[model samples]
Target: KLVVNPEKIKSLKDVKGKKIATPQLGNTQDVAFLNWISEQGWKVDAESGKGDVSVVRTDNKITPDAYKSGSIDGAWVPEPTASKLVSEGAKVLLDEADLWPDKKFVITNVIVRQDFLKEHPEAVEAVLRASVRTNRWIEDNPEKAKAAANAQLKTDTGKALPSDVLDPAWQSIQVTDDPLAATLDTEADHAVEAGLLEKPDLTGIYDLTPLNKVLKAEGEPEVDDAGLGVE
Candidate 1:
């Protein structure tokens, strides 16, 4: 967990009692960290404070500052923010990219209502195509994306993000067009494990025939769930 002791400590042998904070417990970062800790034969002893690390929950802004000021160790956060902390002198303790490696570290996703997907599979395919095109556009024009993010932030939060946070934050977002992206499945699996999902019916969860049609017309193979390595 890069949010705490950001070093490549290699094992739970090192992270035993360091204080850590995340947006919330039972979130992906928290659950994944808990899973890792469990593998180490030591427990997350919140009460005893033995292997007892402090788990503080704080607002987003405080997370970076807390890590920087030494009030907290590290945090599970996305880039540009992770990059922001690093540029502001917080190092990359661990990257989710490193944990999963080229598999998406999904911060967000787009989900259409299943009934809609079923009713208008063509519309789903069109959207996925647009999404892919948008991704390519973003990658080619980072500044435009930044400006868009700034506009959104200003509209919603009424302020521009400081450049330190903005620049790296821009880098952290890896936009992809795969309508049936594997990372979606990965997140789905995570959801089931966390009990956020009662159970995921893979077939029910996807309507990839639309995506398949899109891919075929484009001269690409159909979207492959297995290739995404979600399972």
Candidate 2:
């Protein structure tokens, strides 16, 4: 989520020459923001984060405070940091999902070592089954699932988000078993455009067969790997 203080910044163009905070330089949100800057024909050093806009590398723990203290004009951060900022009178200027096709992109992905997958294919299949089932349950019962997730978050972090912040943030995310392979490729391209990464040859980077098998057995459609899957 990209949020701005409406009093300080009314639009994306207003971000130029302003101080903006990202969790860290070269992190996913940082890369995405840098890429957007490149698209805008603005200049910024990917490593130093110095350019048209002052890209401050701030921790998520302090980003909301930074905004409240008027140190940063805005932030490009993930939830619940984004939600936390919203609670402090920030306006959501953009949701990164809306920038992509189908309003879907990969925020999280499941990975396993090649050796592990090769040795324990059945284990992988079982995990995928559980993942698919969990996604289905979440979709079928969003409010209950949200509460369950908040409970787990509270257990881990010792605090649960208030309803005002949690509701909108939860609504923005779409949980699914699909890895959205094409979006991963696009993100890599974004990193390259932002000068944070060399163009990577990502062929065979995905092995969705186990997930697809689970979906098929459940009478669901298989997801495409965007030509980046193993043969």
Highest lDDT scorer: 2
Candidates' lDDT values, in order? 0.61, 0.91
- Which one wins on TM-score? 2
Q: Residue 43 in candidate 1 has what lDDT?
A: 59
Candidate 2 wrong stretches, greater than 4 Å: none
Model 1 segments beyond 4 Å from truth? Answer: 4-14, 45-51, 65-71, 101-105, 179-203, 218-221, 227-231
Error of 2 at 3 (Å): 0.2
Looking at model 1, residue 203 earns an lDDT score of 51
* TM-score of candidate 1 on Cα atoms, chains taken together: 0.72
Residue 150's lDDT within candidate 2 is: 95
After TM-score superposition, the amount by which residue 108's alpha carbon in candidate 2 deviates from its true location, in angstroms, is 0.8
